[model samples]
Structure formats: C-alpha cells, structure tokens
Target: MHLNHSPNQNIILEHSSIHLAIKREDLIHPFISGNKFRKLKYNIQQAQSDNAFRLLTFGGAFSNHIAAVAYAGKEHGFKTIGVIRGEEIGFKPELNPTLLFAKSCGMQFKFVTREIYRTKTESNFMDSLKTEFGDFFLIPEGGTNDLAVKGCEEILEESDLIYDYMCCAVGTGGTISGLINASKAHQKILGFPALKGDFLQEDIRKFANQDNWELVTDYNFGGYGKIKPELVTFMNSFKDRHKIPLDPIYTGKMMFGIFDLIEKGFFPKDSKILAIHTGGLQGVSGVNDLLKRKNQPLINL
Candidate 1:
C-alpha cells in the first residue's frame, strides 16, 4: 500500500464562524483507503514478519473493512478469508455488492450466523477455523488493534496542531484513538460513533492514552447502518455544496453532527475544527440499493 499524506481541505460555511477543514483521507486509495489503509499498514507488515501469507478478518454484509482487506490481500499477495456475519447471505452472494467485490478480489468467505460470529475471538472458535483452513493472520473486526492505532497516529501531521478540535467518525475506535494520542494537549478530539451505544468508551480507552477526547452520542441516526431520509438529504446537499462524497455509515453521520453542532454554537468563535474523512465510500452502492428499495433519497456519490 502506498502511504501518502492526505491533505486537509478547508470548508467554507456561511452560517457559522467556526473554521472547518476536512482531512481527505478518503482520497488515499480507491479500495484500501482512509483509516482502513492506515489500520492495515502495520498489520500487513506484522503478518509478513510472522511469515503468514493468509489474512483473515470479520465484517457484515456491506462492510468496508471486508472490501478493503480483500483488495489489500490481492494486491499484497496474501490469501484472504472473510468471516462474514450472516450465513444466509452466503447462499445468494450475488445480491450483495460488498461480498461480490470481495469474491472478485479472491477473498474466500466463511459465512457464519450472528450468534457464532459473536465468539470470533474465542479460542474454541479460532481453533475451529485453524482446523478448517491453515494458519492465517487475524485482524479484528473494523481492523482496530495496537498496530492499527500506530498507523492511524500518522494521520495527523505537525501542521494539524493548529486546529482546536480533531473530529472523526468512530467505528471500532482505532482511528479516533490514534487521533487522541497524536493530538496536541490543548486540542480536543471528538468522536462521533456510528453505532448507538456507550460501550465504545471502553473500547477506545483500551488504546487511547490521552483524556482530551469525548464521544458525541446524539447523532447515530438511530444506529449503525441505519439512516433516515433527512440524513440522506443532508449528505446529498453537503456533496452538492462541498463536492465531497461521504459514506452513509460513518463520515456522513459525523458531518451531519458537525453541521448541527455548528448551528447550535457548540464550537467557540474562530475555533478551527478538523474532521477526518475515514473512507467507506465503496459501501455507498449497497446503501443506495437499500434506499431505493425503501423508496427513499439516495446519497450522491
């Protein structure tokens, strides 16, 4: 994977006086882009050091992580296995865009029920997998780990210290954890979780060493993978205005929260805010399919 410095693009907002810029990590790569690219960098190196040529991980029906791991594996000459959640999707994989892409990238699938997937980290489940397949490098769901966090820390450059707030969409908390560690002492790292729960605090604390971060729990738009028509409208309008595409699952929700907070005067006057655009745009096609089926507004790509 080519490690490149993502530029921060200033966003002009007439409604708020806050200085805002978006870290264009989404432009890092077409497939292994954004935080996924960061998260996998060290993990792939560790796998090579350990002499493991196969990479195995977990994700849902439309997981950006799954798509990324597949492409990364193909590009890096490693066999990939995706332990997909939901066994039903395995029977008719063609219907799922994410799974189809992974398959095309030579990623073998081991679809399991949600109940079984819950024990993915357990010794018994892992041993069972090793017996079925050979030894492989294991990446946790959403690719969050110590090595992943180390890669993400590099996302913030020295110039980013000018920003008062560093914001990011939290999935497994890897990206935000890195941001918290890399941020200046006075900078507050705000994480907007895609999932609806307070459990992420613990997950983040496991890796984060700083106390400068807080999770804003009010803008999940119901829950992970759940989106309302208003949120869709906001994302589309944002793209039309800014010419930046945000994935529905993560960045879109975070941007919406930021805009709402701006309207509510959450940030101090003249405060500089930097929002990290963690890439998951590949999943937009799948999301658009769902919206079309529901006869709702589609997120503009």
Candidate 2:
C-alpha cells in the first residue's frame, strides 16, 4: 500500500473537447488510497527523522486523513492521535466505521467542541497540544502545508496526461494548491469548494499564493457534507457512466460543478480538462448510515 507505480490509463470520455485520464490503477484500491498515500510519505519520514513515537493531527468526524494517518502511522511504527472537531456526543463519538478502523489500527482520539476546535490553527492551541501529547509531531489538518502540496504536486508526474484546465474539489485547499503549483505555469485551475461559498476563494488564496487558481462556488450541492436528490442521481449515473464511485463529500460535487460550468458555456469550445478523483471511500458508509439513522431516503434518483 505504501509503494508507487507508473500510471495506468483509464481513458473513459475522450472527445475533441476533453481528454480525461481517469487512471485505472487509481480506481481499484481503497479511496484515500492514492493521494493520501503520497501526502503522508513525507510526514511519516519526518516523524521517523525526529524519532517521534506518536503523530498528532486534526480532522472532522469523517476525515479520510485521520483514517489514512492512522493506517500509515501504524504501518510506519508510529502511534497516531487525532484531535477531532466537534464534541463526542456519546462516549464513542458514535465511532463510525471509518474512525473505528483508524482506532483499530491504533489511533487515539482527543475530542473537542466546534468552538474550541476552530482555533486549532493557532500557535497556542498547538503549543498546548504539544505539551499534552509530549514530543509528538503535529500535522496540520488536511495536510495543506508546503510539504503536503509539494507531495500532491507529484501526482501529475505519475501521468503523462495534461490538461488545459484542471478541476478539483477544494476542502482544505491543499490538493488544489499542490496540483496547481505542480502543473505548468500557464495551466489554469478551477477549484469547487465543498463547503459554503463564503470567503472560500479567500481561503483558497491563502494556500495558492498565486494568480492562476480560480474558485467556483456554484455547485457545492447545498454545502459541506450535505447532499440533494439530484446529487445522488448524478453520483449513481456517474458511477454507471464512468464506473467511478464518487462520495457526496468532495470529488462528486466537483464533478457535478464542472459539468454545470460546461453547460453554462464557462469554458472555451475545445478546452481539455482533467477532473481529479481524490479518494474518500471511507465517507460513503458513514454518509449512508447518516441517511438511514436520520430515516432520510438516500436513493431518490
């Protein structure tokens, strides 16, 4: 799981307007399966370099990074701790299967309320967390720092594919920044925010630090972790169409938004674009459980 290989072309929809490289090797493994693997390589090495026994990080209830961090931490002989956002509702934080797997792989949990969790980026919070955890390496949430972006920037190297404009879902701005920075200086990047549109570009700009990145807030599907019937229909049809499973959280919305933009004549007539499928398969089980637990019908399409 920690190894690297050359890209296998999964040419799904190749028209005159687009040359999409849905890499076949990317689709066969666990979702958090590809990009996260690359992102964590440096972090794990950093921990070992520092001779740290534990790796600490932050994420939401359904964070793919937390799962990957745990999996990778265990793999590399480092203990993992997740300072998760939101308070534990029950003793377990309900322990969703995604988190449960992380925990099973030897991840510890430190739950905090949303209010306090917002300040996780503060030096003080990290200082105190370091004091508490005692000599552990702390990875920022979404792994969006210079290192993660530098690592993610290499995703393009595995492919001989190129795009005039690249489309990706912006969650923490790391992947978009990394990919945009990695691509040629002239290439354009369109980022669709998974969360609300408010100040999203401003948020992205903090990571991008350049002019080539554009934020498209049109197709968030009613905000982060929230979905609609049309989205489910689109996901199912897209799965059938491209045979790629897109969860509701990130990649799915970006794909939907890209099509909507194309419909509105946003891009040029023959724009070659690539849509990144950042893996997040662990999210599906929890989202489906969320629907069922709320008695909400999930398959409306």
Candidate 3:
C-alpha cells in the first residue's frame, strides 16, 4: 500500500546522491499481485458486466498472465480456459509450476502448436475457439487491453508525486502506459522492457497520452524469460540486502537497469526515483528449472 523504499546498499547511489524507493505492487495480493492485479481489475469487471460465463486467454509455457488469470477467474466465479502456446506442456503440467498452479485453480488448457498460437489474433482462429469453447470473454495475451491500462493507471497515486522518476517493467506495454498516463507532469517515467525490440514503443503509444516516458532497452539480458548468471547473483544478493524478492522476468531486470543507470550517473543528483515491483515471482520456479538444466545458479527464492 505504502511506497516502501528499498534499502539498496549499492554504493553508486550514495556517490550519485540519488534516492531510490520501490512501490511494492507485489504486496497488493497473495496470488494476483502487482501489475497483474492492476491489469486484471477492470477486465474482470467488464467480463462480469457482459454476463460472460467463461474467460478465455492466451499465454506461453510459463506465463504469469496465465497463472494470474486462472486464479482470478476461480476466485471471481468465472470458468477459465487457457489457450497455451506449447502443445508439449499439456502432457507435463506437473513439471511446470505456473501451469500446475493454473490447473489447480481449475483452468482448462487448450494447448496449441506454435503455428496455431501465432494466429491468436486472427478472426478465423478466434472463430474456431468460439465454436469449440462456446461463448466466452476474450482476454488478449498479456492482458494489455484498454481496460487493463485503465486498471494500471491506478498503480500511481497522488502520494507518488514526490518522486522525480517513475520506473516499471514493461511486458505488453499496458502497465507503463498507465504509469505514463497517471504520472505527474514533473516526473519522467522510465520503462524497462522485459522483452527485446522497439515495437513496444508503438504499443505503449496506443494507450499513453503523455510524452513523459522512455524505455530503457539495455537490461533485457537476452529477451523475455531469458536470464544470465550475473542477473541471478544480483537478484539473490538484492533479496539478501532488501528482503524483497524480485522475479527474473520483469522486476529483476528493471532493478538491475536502475542500479546500472545509477552507477553511470543517469539520474541527476538528489533526484528521487520510484521503481515499481510488478510481481511475477510465480515464474521463478520455471526459470530455476531452466537454470538447473543449464547448470547455472538458480534464483534464491
């Protein structure tokens, strides 16, 4: 609820005379946390308003969106169906924590091949899904519709106006768009995109009216769901110092970029920075599994 400051012991902050605090959106809900909660809030309302009996969405192997939607659907009395990207995942749900959690929350899986999944936004594919699943509320992948942006706009409050900079991890561009819309005129919003490319800038501009935002494209490591050993070490040490666990997919990359920028003197002296922790901790198990296979250090969850 409160804008809790992170006690970052990174020496660069002290040298740069910059202040950093984290708005812990992750603490908003146990299951439906952070930006996921914000993104889903209005979408759920819209679905209910339409008298929809079921909610159908899309996601990949270990998508936080899938997990959040499943839990939110079960808790709010809507049947959930996930049109998963990988067909192989259907056979080994138990091995994947995100999928397992979704299944436990009573989400039915319609695992499709990558080729079919690529047509998720096509009319014919959607028509086929409607034919098979019957009438349902459609939530796009990553839950970044206009309504989701509306919900995320509430992530920043008047109390947050004291900060000079507002930063968040960008997935489908919904959360940063909301932050850009809600941010004070004096504050500059920075987005650390979890995935690669300049394409998200266009997606964000579709919802964002303000021009006070820029995406920091350096800290993605490799891309979405990709992590390096150095990142794992930083995340583990950061948790040790701050007692706040960051997921590798989003918040961790954002924080890593924030610290690196601080070291590089990107922020002006005496500037206050507020970084949002958009919770995706559920995906850590899946990431750790990959790390194990690679014989790399796992995230200390």
Candidate 4:
C-alpha cells in the first residue's frame, strides 16, 4: 500500500505489492495520478510527433481527462484546446468547475452543441478545427485515441498479473480495451460500462483495434454519474472490508458488478481476480455531497 492520505477522509488505496518490470516514472504527476497519466502519455507524444503545436480534445464540464490534458499539455508547453460538450451561457467569468480550471490553467475552450459534438470524427469538423486552431493534433473525446490506447496498453505491462481476471469501469472503453490487447495472460477483461452503454464495445474495437473484452452494463445505477442508496452503502462496506475506496461513477459500479457477477457464478470460485483501480477517487467527493443533499442513508448489504 503506497498512497498519501489527505487530512480529510478521502483515502486512496494503492497496492505496492503489485510491482512491475516496465514502470514509467511520469505515471505519478501531481494531478496526472493513476490511470490518467497512462491514458494521456502517448497522446501527448503523438501530438508532438505530428509537428502539432496545439492539442485539441473533447469532454464534459467536470471531466478529469479534460483537466489532465489541459494541465499536461501546458506542462509540456503545447497550446491546448477543450471542446466542451454543452453550450456556455450567461456572462459568467468562472463557469463550471472544469471550465474554470481548464481556462485558469491556460487551456482554451470552445463550446459546441450536443448534435455537432456527436460528429467528432467527421472530416469537415476536423478540417474546421484544424483551421481554427492552426495545425493541431486531434485527440478524441476523453482522449480515447489510438495513441491513448497505446499509452494505456503500457499500463497492463506495468501491472503484475497474478490474477485470473482484470476488471475496470469503462467510460470510453479505451482503458480496458488497451489492457486487453496488451495482456499476455489468459485473463478476462471485465468492463463495467459507465455510459447507458452506447455500443462502447464497438467503439473499443474501433479505438483499440481489439475484441478481447466484455462489457458489464448491469451496474451503472441507472446512468452515468447516477448513484443509488444501495451503491452508497455498498461503497462504504467495500471500504470497510477490502478498504477499497471507489467512486460512484466508475470503480464503485465496477466492484458492484464484479461482486454480483461473482454471486451469480460468473467466475469459478478458485478464480483469482485483480480489479484495476482506475482512479476516479476525486469524483466520489462530489458524490458525498449529492448523497447528503438527497438525504441518502448508509446501510449495509
């Protein structure tokens, strides 16, 4: 266990015993902690390799990936742009949490409608953005690109594979897809889909160029970022038991699905599974606030 705890109760549980041979030093940047570094590493390199002076990507208001890209791009001294999913309203200087942070950190943002935002890979849009930004590298939404796949593929190489299966919450599916492709061990890539699913497995193969992955969409708790009372209690007990801290959006639902599938006899009793702690612990802080507002109670399973 190698994690620094804050004075507040926000705990990040890490396993030092799961050491690897090909460890990358830049995996632990100040805000680029956890899978963010792995997920963004090759994307940044690709931007530079393509003679791109600017890097443009897409995300929602409070996306960690967007934040990371902004910070990392600025750190690497590349001009960064964020294609925000929703329209910006009012004459507000400070927008949402992510918008404010991205702008403050020197990442320029362009707001777009949901319909236009959907056509992210269309040639017309790409050409227009290229013209606007002046020769920029295009990273997909959530930084889920081939380069990001290659980068996250390195995460599997960095992990010790003593388990029969690998599980992680899938937002873009790039993370699990990359790991599935990079893995040599005969392990199942159990992915908990964070979206309404939206054919993420197809998107995975499109982005990752691989088919060796499974999508567990049963435990999304209705939709992305939505949480139920059972989920909160389950998260608490999981912390009490394995001491595994989880976000309601990603890892929490992942663990919920994993345990439910286990109870349903999805895996053999002897199967040794290693759940990938693809960190989104910061997301849980906001979840706590939500639970408090809704007067959600904490009870055990």
Candidate 5:
C-alpha cells in the first residue's frame, strides 16, 4: 500500500528548527495496520507454506497483537487461538474491546493465569499447548520473531533515506530491530520504549545487524499498560493540534519523547526526522475505560 509521508506542522518543530514527517503506517489497514501488518506479513506466508490450519499467539486483555492476529487469521482462512494472559478475561471477554474484537473475528481463547503465561516460552508449556490444541503455527507474544523482523525491514523504503533520524515506539523490540537493520548509514534510529527497561536493547541486538540505534528509556510513564494524566492530556492536545490519534501504549509515548527531545535541544539544528506511527489505536477504547474508572482525563479519540 502507498502511504502518505505527511509533514507534521506542530509549532514545537518550527521553534526547534527540526523538520518532522510521520509515515502513516497506521492508515495501511483498518484492522491489520502498521507494524502489526509488517510483523505478520511474512509469518502468515510461512504458516501457509507449512500447511498450518491454525495460528496460535499470546497477548493480554487489551493487546493489539491479539486483535490483529485474530483478524489476519480470519481474513486469510486460518483459525486463530489467542493464549490470553489473564484467566479472568476468558469468562468476561465482553468487558474488553480488544478481546471482544478478537472473539468477533472467530479467535478461540486459552486464557492462562499470569504464572502460566510467564512459562509461555518454556518447552513444557509448548508441549501442553500442543497436546491440547494440536498442530499450529506459534507466534510469540507481541509476534516478534525472525520472520516478523524480516517483514518489518520492508517498513523503510528508499524514499526515507533523506531523513537523518528514524524514530519509533518500542514494544517487544521487533519493529526497531527491523528499522535498525534497514536504516541508512547516516541515519540514527531512536527508539522510545513504552515499557521500562534496558533489556530491550539486548533483544533488539539479536535481530539488528547495524549499530545505528539507541533506546530512550525515560518515556514509559510507569510500565507496560500504565499511564499518567499528563500523558492523557498530551495525547488529546496532540490529536487536536495534529489531527493524528496516538494510542497511549506506544506511539503516543514515542511522540511525546520525540517532542520532548526536540524542545530540550537533543537533536542538532536542521535535522530531518521521520517517525513511524506503529498503529495500536484499537486499544484506545480499553484505555479510556481505565481512565474513566480512575476519574482521570480520557484520551480524546
């Protein structure tokens, strides 16, 4: 799909003498959008090549991966099984938009306790799932694997070489690893992790061939799925100003870091920047619910 590489006209960029453009990967597809689409592209092909009838993956109550894989599996004629993180969600799927959407797409769920879900990468867990669900293609939590990284490398095109910096939100590190591999020699890739940690650097290094990348670890609000009122306010104001909706889990935090860096003079003057908007807009409804319960300001969707 041909996506628009639109310039962001935020006044902050003007004041900082930085030129920023957003690669609208979010608009790639309504259901299978952004990095999820990239990450799943080759994995889906591989699953078909292996003659798999089912695609089994992992996720939490409000996971974007769960929703994407479910839709992708349904659209491509493969049955999907979501190994959901919380056992409670299995009985109350209707309460969460992400899970509800996946269920609507014909995904079966195997909700596990947080403890069992922690053993998801172990051989014993794999054996148990195999005994229960039969032969299936396994996509790891967040769908990060060799094939997924290979698919993500296609995210940056020749036209993107003009940019000096490539920026994106980091989740399981798959997207940034692909960006790091595909990045131009002169371009420095900066990742704003949505979760707190230095562990992602090592994970990203496993797939990344180039060393032109660094992770900005300060923007993760608290941790995964954790958000603050300031972040909510920024997201709403940013959408009102830029006409772009950013999900709090990833892109919103990345953009917040980018704008903060620009304001703090982190980038050299006259630098050209391209931010990859990896879509997770589907999780916004779920996030708003949490905000409502807390009596905090909700993100203006």
Candidate 6:
C-alpha cells in the first residue's frame, strides 16, 4: 500500500506568458497510477473493512481501471473479476495487451456486449453477478464512487493553492470533482471531457461541491478512444520537447487543449495554471496496436 508524492513540474514556454505546471500523478505507481490510484485507494480499504474479499468491476477493452484493479487486487490479496464490455475480446484475450496484462495479474474476465455493460449498475445485474461471483465487492465502471472521490481529494496539497486554474481530464468526472472540492475559492477547475456531450455537466455536478469549474469541449478529438493524426503528432512532439509522455485517451487530450488554449490567448497574462496528468499510459500500447492495424501514425513510446 505504499504511495509516492506527485510532484508538480513547471512547463517552460518561450512565447506564452501563462505560467503552467503539470502535476505528475502519472508517476504515482506503475500499474495503479494517477487518478486510478486515487479512485481505488479508499474503495479497497472499504472492501477490506466490509470483509469482502473478491472484487468485481467493469471496463472497456483497453481500460486502465481494469488493469489497476487487477494489479491492486493481486497486491492486496483480493480476488478480482472484470466484467468487460465487448464479448468478442473474451474469445481472443491474447490479442489485447491490457486484457493480457490483467489476466497475468490473476483477474478473471466476464465479457458482455455494450448493451449489457450499460446495465452494470442496476440491482438485477449486480444480483446476477453476486450469484455468479459469490458476494464480491462491486466497484462501478471508471471507479467513481463516494470513497473514490474522497481519495482523489487528496491529489491537491497546500502548495497547490498558488495556482489560479487547475486542469484535469474528465472521464466519469470523479477526478475533477475531487479537484473542485479541494481547490481554493480563487482557483478555478477546468475539465476536458473525453467523451462528447453535455451530460458530464450533470454528472460532475453530482459529486462536485463547488461552482468554479468549466468544461473545455473542443479537444475530444472525435469522441472517446478516437484520435486524429494531428493529435498523435502533437503528443509525440510534446514528449520530445517537454520530456513528458501523454496518453492518447485522457491526459493527451487535456494537454493538447491546454497548449491550444495558450496559443489562442485564453489564459490571462501571468495566470498560474496546473494540469493534472491522470495516467492511462498503459493503454498506449493497445492504442498503438490499433493504429498499426489501421495504417495510421502511431504514438511514440
């Protein structure tokens, strides 16, 4: 259960007057990195306190949550089950790096269709899972829960109060919600949603207690898990310049947004900004595999 401090590294820009720093939450751990670590920390403890040994969760094919839960459960001596979307992957798990890694970590998989995966939170679906897995601890998809939010609230430290704007990639909204709740009154939290839609405003409002936040919707790059060649180019160039790697799904999009916003003069002069690097680097390999198959430019590892 050892955790490391996430350092805030300053990003030097030659032209832009906006001061930017990124919280290296990605460096928190190998498998349980970034917001995954924060989201799971308290959930695991609650499961242990409840004396629930087996842990069951949900995710897509290249899900960081599934990988983190698999490794964390193995590390904590809990049996893990991943109810994955896309039943086709169940028949050929060896082809997917994320699934193979989870399997190597001793996670059992139950594959279902996208339609079935949507009902994952329903009582009937959960009762069926309980019947099959026998009283396992259930963690919601993307690991967004009250306890998870509590853990994510620990991401910001006292030193973070110096920043005027805090930025983070929004998935299920837990990470930004925690930031919003933990941030100072003067600090504004900006969320870059991975998925398309205004639904996140409602979702984020469910957990976020503060009103000092805005969603930058322009950089989703054609929805979740979808990317353009320009984005791949930017990510590679960003890594080459800053010595920081950005995952395609979450952090990459947020970083791209931040840089673009800077170029557009969105931030006022001398406005201190902090962007959270919520890790999903493990999925880069899987994404590269997809890109290779699609004959598109791949993200450099």
lDDT of each: 0.94, 0.74, 0.90, 0.69, 0.90, 0.94
Task: Give a tens-digit lDDT track for model 6, residues 1-301.
Answer: 6788789999999977889999999998988989999999999999999998899999999999999999999999999999999988888999999999999999999999989999988899989998888989889899999999999999999999999999999999999999999998999999999989999999889999989999999999999998999999999999999999999999999999999999999999999999999999999999999999999999999
Instruction: Give a tens-digit lDDT track for model 3, residues 99-143.
Output: 999999999999999999999999999999999999999999999
The better-scoring model by lDDT among 1 and 3 is 1
Models sorted by TM-score, best on top:
6, 1, 5, 3, 2, 4
* Model 5 C-alpha lDDT per residue in residues 1-301, reported as the tens digit of each score: 2334433333345545798888888988888878999999999999989999999999999999999999999988999999999898778889999988999999999999999999999999999999999999999999999999998898888888989999999999999999999997999999999888789988998999999999998899998888999998899998998889999999999999998998888999899999999999999999899889999999998
Question: Which residue ranges in model 1 land beyond 4 Å of their true spot?
Answer: none
Model 4: CA > 4 A from native: 1-27, 88-95, 207-212, 240-243, 286-301
Candidate 1 C-alpha lDDT tens digits along 4-44: 66889999989667999999999988889899999999999
Model 1 Cα displacement at 185 (Å)? 0.4
Tens-place lDDT digits, model 2, residues 15-97: 43645554332453453465676577677777788889998999988888888888888777888999988786326765587
Model 6: clashing residue pairs? none
lDDT of 2 at 301: 22
**Pairs with backbone N, CA or C atoms under 3 Å apart (clashes), candidate 2:** none
Clashes of each: 0, 0, 0, 0, 0, 0
Each prediction's TM-score versus the true structure: 0.98, 0.88, 0.95, 0.80, 0.96, 0.99
lDDT of 6 at 59: 96
Candidate 3: list runs displaced more than 4 Å. Answer: 1-13
- Looking at candidate 6, what is the lDDT of residue 72? 94
Task: lDDT winner between 2 and 6, please give it.
Answer: 6
For lDDT, candidate 5 versus 6, the one ahead is 6
Candidate 6 lDDT: 0.94
Error of 4 at 235 (Å): 2.1
| Residue 212, model 6, lDDT | 98
Quote the lDDT for 122 in model 6.
89
